[model samples]
Target: SQQGEEDPQALSIQEGENATMNCSYKTSINNLQWYRQNSGRGLVHLILIRSNEREKHSGRLRVTLDTSKKSSSLLITASRAADTASYFCATDAGAGNQFYFGTGTSLTVIP
Candidate 1:
């Protein structure tokens, strides 16, 4: 169980359905980040929630962090076909500006 390593390596959902993914990490962190990457493009920042924060939201994206459980979850509501992409979670340990990334979740929103 390394830092920022999470589950559900892949996910598939229909358009208009919601999608959820989880991320877990070890040790203390300053903030957790979620990113989305298209097939061959770079990652796009989704959201970042601080350690002191329980949850945050941006548009159709909702993020929750529980330091007690050392885990975080991302929820995308009313998903769309254009939302199809691989999502990765990142954690900034706040130590020397280092960040750890999760394996990533491949999401396919079928029309």
Candidate 2:
């Protein structure tokens, strides 16, 4: 299957703290992308790391990929209340117009 699955379906952390989530997939992929959704807002892309990449970072977010294990991890450092949202991991199947996403991890950054 192309779908990725993330651990810790939910998490709650204090503002200024850090949160981490992991994702695992079953098929080969061209790239993996992370997205964040706040309440009813549309998802916003956080970062995309190609299959050839091992690690990538954007602002306070860091992502690591282990192709051998078909797994990836996302780390949010110094998270704020504004960071409260649902995070999802998506994989491009390398085929045209094909992508799959995980169920998502619900995060609440408490102030």
Candidate 3:
């Protein structure tokens, strides 16, 4: 297994519905972070759930971690056109605690 490998390489959802994506890793982590990146834009930090946390939420975003399974999921409530972007999971687990970014889930929220 990779350090961070996200599931559902692509997703399409209508506005107002929720979107969910999962990520799995192979190593223990200090924290796992989610990020959003608009096409041709820089990444925007979404949320960071620590190893001790089971879940965390921010605004319409919710994140859950299961260390035993080395997996995590991110859910965005009330999808919007503006939310169309690529979502990625990053873990602070590699050498020297560097971050490992996964292949993201590209989401298109149609209005």
* Maximum-TM-score candidate: 2
Query: Could you tell me which 10 consecutive residues in candidate 2 have the lowest summed lDDT?
Result: 92-101
What's the CA error at residue 105 for candidate 3, in Å?
Answer: 0.1
Q: Give candidate 2 misplaced runs (Cα > 4 Å).
A: none
**RMSD after Cα superposition, model 3:** 1.3
| Per-residue lDDT over 31-92 for candidate 3, one digit per residue giving the tens place of the 0 to 100 score | 89999999999999999999999999999999999999999999999988999999999998
- Candidate 1: where are CA atoms >4 Å away? none
TM-score of 1: 0.95
lDDT of 1 at 11: 90
In model 3, the worst 10-residue window by lDDT is: 91-100
Each prediction's RMSD over C-alphas, in Å, is 1.3, 0.9, 1.3
Ten-residue region with minimum lDDT total, candidate 1: 1-10
Clashes by residue pair, model 1 = none
lDDT of 1 by residue, 1-111 (tens): 345876788899999999999999988888999999999999899899999999999999999999999999999999999999999999987572778898998999999
Error of 3 at 77 (Å): 0.4
